[model samples]
Target: MQIRTNALVSSVKNFLIEVGGIIDFTVLVFKQFFKKPREHKEMIKQAYYAGNKTFPLIAITGFIMGLVLTLQSRPVLVEFGAESLLPGMISVSIIREIGPVITALLCAGKIGSGYGAEIGSMRVTEQIDAMEVSGINPVSYIVASRIMATTIMVPILVLLADAIAIYGSYVAVNMYSDVNFQLFYNQAYNTLSFKDLIPATFKTIIFGFMIGLIGSYKGYYSKRGTEAVGAAANSAVVTSSLAIFVIDLVVVQVTELF
Candidate 1:
């Protein structure tokens, strides 16, 4: 009984710590965002690195996701003789849920972890200290830029992912049935409304914020030595993934209530 109680207390303590960390990180990012903008060159370079360079991975992942979703969904749809709805169903799922969520998860694994390790390493090596000594605002240069870059780039990536996923769905559709390009797209678009598009896109912005916030927070506060860098990276991914789900739940509930 004592052991179980101790375990429960530990879990709660860990949860609270994570929540506090998230809040602190968010405050720091926002504070930095509103501060005098410095390091434009560094910020731009980071944006290109974080955003442009991530495109290939995002595209490939998006393609495979659509293809697999369609391929797997076919038999189920066929059973209902609703294969005609393939494009529409896939499109809704992709745009409304899969595209943004999957893209964010991928980003969490790739970009989130990258940010954590990179910054954590800097912290471990006292590069951050050197920056302060050199009269550089490390928060604005590192955290603000990353947060801004993720915010700006994630939505764009989701849009591209949506398009590529649709194309992939088209290919998957053709494997078992014939669908003209125009007709397929028409069917797909006919089912989508501003309602689905707006909410999904909005949620993605939150997802991006969470990813950047968590990654930057872990890295910024990391302790110990080089090993802390790896730990920060790992924790950032794990926590950001959880944050995505938690935020999604709330978003969905709120959307439904509205």
Candidate 2:
């Protein structure tokens, strides 16, 4: 019993220590964000990777999400004679929650792992150290730019995914009844308000920030080795995914109160 207790305590202590380290790292990145010689070109490059490179996967995922959801839910709603509400139901679900969450999780897996491996390799190669010795701020040029890229691109990706998902839902709806595009569009549009869109988009920005920050953090502090690069990539994916769910829960609860 004592051994188990000690193990648990040690684990918690290490976790908290790592959390504190992440906070400090985040502060350093933020401080560098405002410093001179803004890394606009790097930021844009990161954004392109985060957004354009990730879009095809998101497009397929979003379409499947909407199609599967509509197909699964349609039968139940049809039984309850609520089939008319299908468009609104799907719109609310995809836009208000599913779209953002799915996009963020995908980004966490792809962009987060990419960031970690990329930076971890740099660390292993001593590139970051070389940059520091050359009077270059790694935090500013690398971390801040990547974080900003994720912050800007993830939300845009989420929005694009939401649109694609809705179109896919419309396609699914047509598989059964001959619902007109205009009618489906009206139904979906009417059900959505600024309240739904704004909060969802806001949470996605937070999701993006977390994904980038956690990935960068893992890579930036990774142990110097080839094995450590893989470990950092895996750790970044796991941590960023967990952070997305936690942040989504908090955002939902806070949004409910407003």
Candidate 3:
């Protein structure tokens, strides 16, 4: 009983420590973000890296996912003579669930890992300390800019992914049956309510923020040595992906409440 009690206490203490670290990190990031003169140049460059360079990855996956989803769903949907509902069903699935979740998971793997490795290497190499000695705020220059880029770019990627995915669905549907572009979208658009669009988009924004925050935090505080660099990247991706799943569950619950 005493050992079990001690273990429980240790778990609680660790949880509190983690919560405190996140809070402190958030405070520092806000301080950087609201500094008198913003670092527009770095932020822009990060945005390009986060959004533009990541576009092809997002697009290819989205297109394939849409094609697969439609094809897989066809037999089930057609069995009940519900073929006409294909566009609407696919749209709802893509916009409400698949698009946001898949895009976020992909970003968490790709972008999160990259940020973690880049900053973790800087930390391990003492470049971060050198920047501070040279009078540049490393956290602001590194963390703030990356976070800003992610917060802006992930949503745009989600939007693009949704469109591409729907187009892929259109192609799939047309291959199996005679469906015109206008008619396919007419059914699709009619089924998508503001509820689906707003919640999904909002959650992706939160996912983006968490992805950036987790990556930068892990990287900036990485342990010494090269192995720590890999550890940071791995932890960043794993932790960000878990956070995305958790946030998604909470969002789904809250949105259902509405």
Candidate 4:
């Protein structure tokens, strides 16, 4: 019993230390943002890579998500004789919650892992150390660029995903019932408000920041070895994915109070 209690205490201590380290690292990266010689070129390059690489996957997933959701929901709504609410229902769900969260998770897997592996390899190879020797700020050039890129690109990706998902929902709606394009469009559009759109988009930006931060942190602090690179990549994906769900839950609970 004493051993078990000590083990649990050790685990909690380690967890707290990790959290504190991340907080310090985050503050350091944020400070770099205001420093001179801003990495606009690197940031733009990272942003372009982020969007270009992730767009295809996001499109496919968004379409399938909407399609499956509508197909599953149609029967239940039909039984209740509320099939007319299908378009509005899909739009609200896809826009306000599902789309942003799914897109963020997808990015947490793809972009987050990519950043971790790339930076971890650099760390292992002493590239980061070489940069420091050359008087280049690794935090500014590497970490800041990535976090900013994700912060800007994620909301845009969420918007695109929301649009594509709505269209997919339309296709599913017409699978069994006749939903005209104009009528479906109107219903979906009318149901959405600034309240839903603004908060969802804002949440995605936070998601993007967390994904980038966690990925970069894992990579930057990884042990100096080849195996550490892989470990960093894996942990980045897991951490970012978990963070997305936690942030979503907190945001939802807070939004409900308003």
lDDT of each: 0.89, 0.95, 0.93, 0.93
Backbone clash total, candidate 2: 0
Poorest 10 consecutive residues by lDDT, candidate 1: 37-46
**Which parts of model 3 have CA positions greater than 4 angstroms off?**
1-12
lDDT of 2 by residue, 154-254 (tens): 99999999999999999999999999999999999898998899999999999999999999999999998899999999999999999999999999999
**By the lDDT metric, which is better: model 2 or model 3?**
2
Q: List the candidates' TM-scores in order.
A: 0.95, 0.98, 0.95, 0.98
lDDT of 1 by residue, 149-250 (tens): 887777888889999999999999999888899999999999999888998999999988888888888999899698999999999999889888998889
**What is the alpha-carbon lDDT of model 2 when measured against the actual structure?**
0.95
Instruction: Give the lDDT of residue 13 in candidate 4.
Output: 100
| lDDT score of residue 2 within candidate 2 | 100
Winner by TM-score: 2
Worst ten in a row by lDDT for model 3: 30-39
lDDT of 4 by residue, 191-252 (tens): 88888988898899999999999999999999988999999999999999999999999998
Q: Going through the candidates in order, what is the number of backbone clashes in each?
A: 0, 0, 0, 0
Residue pairs clashing, model 4? none
lDDT of 3: 0.93
Is 1 or 2 the stronger prediction by TM-score? 2
Off by over 4 Å in 1: none
For residue 89, give model 1's deviation from the true position in Å.
Answer: 0.4
**lDDT per residue as tens, model 3, 1-258:** 999999999999987986688779989998888895577899999999999999999999999989999999999989999998999999999999999999998998989999999999999999999999999999889999999899889999999999999999999998889998999999999999999999999999999998999999989989999999999999999989999999999999999999
